[model samples]
Target: MAAQHFRVLARDPNTRARLGELHLAHGTVATPVFMPIATQGTVKMLTADDLEALGAQMLLANAYHLHLRPGETLIAQLGGLHRFMGWQRPILTDSGGFQVFSLSTLREVTDEGVRFRSHHDGTDHFLHPETSIRIQEALGSDIAMVFDDVVAYPCPREQAQAAMERSLRWAERCRKAHRRPDQLLFAITHGGVYADLRRWCTERLVAMDFPGYAIGGLSVGEPKEQMFGMVALSTELLPDDKPRYLMGVGTPADIARAVALGVDMFDCVLPTRLGRTGTAFTAQGRLNLRNARYATALEPLDPTCDCVTCRRYSRAYLRHLFKAGEATGPRLLTYHNLHFYLRLMDRLRAAIVAGTVHQIVDEMTRLFPDEPSEREA
Candidate 1:
């Protein structure tokens, strides 16, 4: 009945990927699900109803953002993020580690935690592992990530090694500090792209016995091969029964590759973020509605997708809305993209259950030809 429980129904013949069900407080979420990021308590233009219709059962929010804006107590007093944001589905809140790291200009990291001035105002504050845990518990997310030191791209071996070692210690502190039985705690593995370091961190976190695991320190100007290699190697070390999450990952190609390496859960800002910019993800590839190519095109975003956007709106109409800056356009596209991810995971699970994941991946590779775009180009 707890969120941490995972029941594996099937496994891929060629890889560690498996079909499984996760028990969460809001409901049961199928494995390989994409939890869209909703920092500051909203998924931008889309509502909870739209997300529910799009088949999203779980989503992600951030403890760091909420702590800065409006504060956690305000959200809790207003009846937690679910009611405060009008989303009743399950939510997983990230610890402030990533955000703190991102505020490099305003911060100094010590063993106690990170101290920085709020990017909003000039007010100073601090967030340690226990403090992050307390903030997430106050926000009442169904799942919470451990506070780990996240290093930027191309960090030195000495710095990366130090952070990696400290992260293991922090994971234990977070595990010990976490008091919510309803909220599952997931330890994050952070070691840049080093094989030995990934192994060292994974082994240490696994020994701490967290309910779930995540692969972090990626998507920050690293090569795709390095990211994929870290994922492949780290997933190998995670416990087989626990859920494996690839944080901030959700490109169609990214999900496809990660699933093959046995990652069961993903949370990313890409879908909604790209959707806001009038781009859409398709089995074939990503598309930009802002393109003049869509001006007269009457087909749906994806001819194969059954989302409401595909069922109703034409590419021409969507392109017009994006150009015109209509609010609904981004909302509808976001819904469609979320639907595509949830449906893709559904298909992945079914293929695994049917013992044809290899064929499925091969078929997906054939349909979606382009690999992950490493750079903006």
Candidate 2:
């Protein structure tokens, strides 16, 4: 049977901030949501159950890493990616384009696709748009991305424009090649700061008719203004019925600002990756669990948070675990950080639904205007 389709639930009275649902083969997802990075088909220390408990209805997986590690054929024979990963919720797989771009020596981009060396063992590999579609089909993700050329940070206008054009052409090829009706293919817009190129990509994709769209290659070491411009401009041009995803976006501040500008989905590695190094997100501000100031602190990670990390543990204990090289330290911090991000999304969704998204943004900024970066809760 065909799966259910995306539905618009609400829209902010004052802005483009919208509330919607993405129905997939696995389940439905709330819009304006943050997808935790499960790069290797796992969100670091989190299990599927943990994700559900935290209200996470979807997640993002990495094609390049999975292709290198487990090999695609194995996942296909093992009942596709769903059984291999044990995640029953909706999953989105990125085309290997961004990953190949990052591996400078190993990759060469052409009009057809990218040719590159495997980062794992210097093995040769090739990834084209149609090829990416085939791989994600084997992975059986609910949402798959088009293979796109990602310009490196600090690239020239002409270079960025060239990459965006390639990305748009690739997106058309991907949409035509895609075979899974159950899996939604989202085209990416890769214009760096060139509004004209961004508009071109958006206009082209809207014509190509992807089920959804993504704003890509923005936060690649560009200044905050450029990143926001990429998002705001792309969001302005995208169709209202489809979801707008901000690919590889940034910190809490970045998320808040992008959400305000009407982005519907976000995926980033900051929370889990930073958690391992003792960085955590709190309502007050960022916290480094390893800080000496937390040595004797007894407060919950965040006073208003109701997650397990806050409901049960203290800052001092978590600090001790991290200092003592215990695995529990990273686990606790990861849980707290993910919980915080997920909750932030929930609040934003609620605000959009309630016709008070702008008010929520104002209140959040006023309340957190800079949570004293203090060790105190």
Candidate 3:
């Protein structure tokens, strides 16, 4: 049913990279795309108009956060998340499994569901796989991820196997419970860095025949090589006709590498989060605007960036804004960082069409030479 919503148009000769399109209820989105995190229905310090201006194809929002705050019923009453957020493009709502699991000290996971205390008010709550599906359906996102059991990196083999099996069971529950025909439910594969477990999970999930698949339980403090290895295995096992999403992944280099491995969709909070902390992503590397060296620099944030922030504002002015604690400083940096990411996807897609995806990967590898840090990866 949901398979009719996506199609691959082109593929890279050298890699698994492909050019594709997601035909969603709201709008169409291109493959190898990076979705900006709009966790609370809005990207911090940015508006729907701003996101549109920045050329963001789709936004990633959290069902857990929105379910806790404002509630899903209210959003549905307000004409769903699209009208509620004033963004008419495609939106993907995470199953909230990660957020629930992140409260490790305050939560307990069982085959039935997860029982947890909200970080906001210490309130008690339970999220079943069925419950996650209902919440996402009420929110009315174009793509809804299945609720999965997420385990930390370096987890014991036995524990990883148990969690992976539980995630597959939950995926089955979500598939049966999802009722929104307009919204596509995606399955998430969880194997915690074990090649065999990853393959097992991927094979089983692919059999479920979801419209799309997301490689989850990664980018959670694992070594880059291990993460990529798992991703490679998962993507290889997943069906080529379906889109593969790498959840909560990555930097520019990470995106490039994942794209090469056959990932089609990605979402991360790095750009906005780093921007708020006075950091800017540039071709050369991350630039700390708080540094004294930038206080006298007159060039733009990234000389190659055509974003409004980079086109009009000088590095000295941006540093001054940050140093002076002006709110506009973070907004500008966030805009440009988003621009950089979206632009990177655009370039990759073009390369895929041009049969030169490796050129973009080479450029990204050169710009981001260091190994991915746990905090950012």
Candidate 4:
């Protein structure tokens, strides 16, 4: 049997969407899955039990953060990320190339590797493809991403091409350096907003043939039309039998659109991030608990939601908590927001199977009135 395998169980006739299974070392992860971010080995404010309650099957962690903090060696000593975090399901770890470039200052990028100062302290650190693979292996995640040069949005075509070429070189090194047979190494496609360069990067990575693939370098301050165009082009070339992940993406509409383009996996911090700011996602649209409008509202955050927060509390009470500067406000909203995303994915998976993905997209459009205009291509 192959160490990593993806089998298509169903495909939508109208869209590129597919219902699939990702066979990994830890277990089988249902495709069209949403993996919440667990940056420091934990999905902030929510416990492992809370995750289980929400039916979360997988999560994403940052090897960069773990390696910088308690350290990957310590995590391995505690018996890998799964045991250390108490999450028995599949986990994917970013190679930290993005964080290094985005979060740190005084960085140098060469064909050999990237060197930058630690965001935690001012100390310098270097991360190359081989070192990234070693860090992920120590974490023992089910999936490890190749370290790639992620270029910022609106970059010059010349700079984009250079970044794409460098990413290709790094991917090859990661492919050769990855040692864990139990882990599936996935290559990331990078090329800013240039279609030709994006196509070139995808072709090169496909030739290298990593077990899985991720569409990176999107959602990086680019306009919606350009990002969707890139996603459409990237998905067109990626192998149908392998899982495709859209890294660090996005809103409900974003996920639905990517799924329509045949993406299988996603990870984002949007829900938790917004939840911390007293925002909640409802079927109608986003609701700000900080607003005085919800102060006397007796409705649940989302009448349709079955999450604990919705079942137990009202918008009035949640607004009161936030207005009063209570910590529980964020906690409750975070749980509900995660529940909303997971439930959205659940609906998407079902829609894929039912061959009604287009309908789901339209429904989400009506629900999020601001979305269609924003995602217009």
Predictions in order: lDDT: 0.82, 0.81, 0.90, 0.89
**Ranking of all candidate structures by their lDDT, best first:** 3, 4, 1, 2
16-52 per-residue lDDT for model 3 (tens digits): 8999988999999989899999888999999999999
Candidate 2 deviant stretches above 4 angstroms: 1-4, 363-377
- Give the top-scoring candidate (lDDT): 3
Which tens-of-lDDT digit does each residue in 152-214 have in candidate 4?
Answer: 767999999998899999999998898898999999998899999889999988888788899
Every model's TM-score: 0.94, 0.94, 0.97, 0.96
TM-score of 2: 0.94
Best by TM-score: 3
Give, for candidate 3, the lowest lDDT window spanning 10 residues: 368-377
Q: Pull out the clashing pairs in model 4.
A: none
In TM-score terms, candidate 3 sits at 0.97
* Each candidate's clash count: 0, 0, 0, 0
Candidate 2 local lDDT, 1-377, one digit each (tens): 21236667888887778888888889878888899888888888888888888888788998878888797889999998888988788899988787787753557889988888876788888788888989899889998999999986788889989998888888889888998877888888877878888888789888887788888877677776766777888888887788889887656666666788988898888778778889888877778888899999999888899999999999999999999999988988888889988888888888887777777667556544532111000
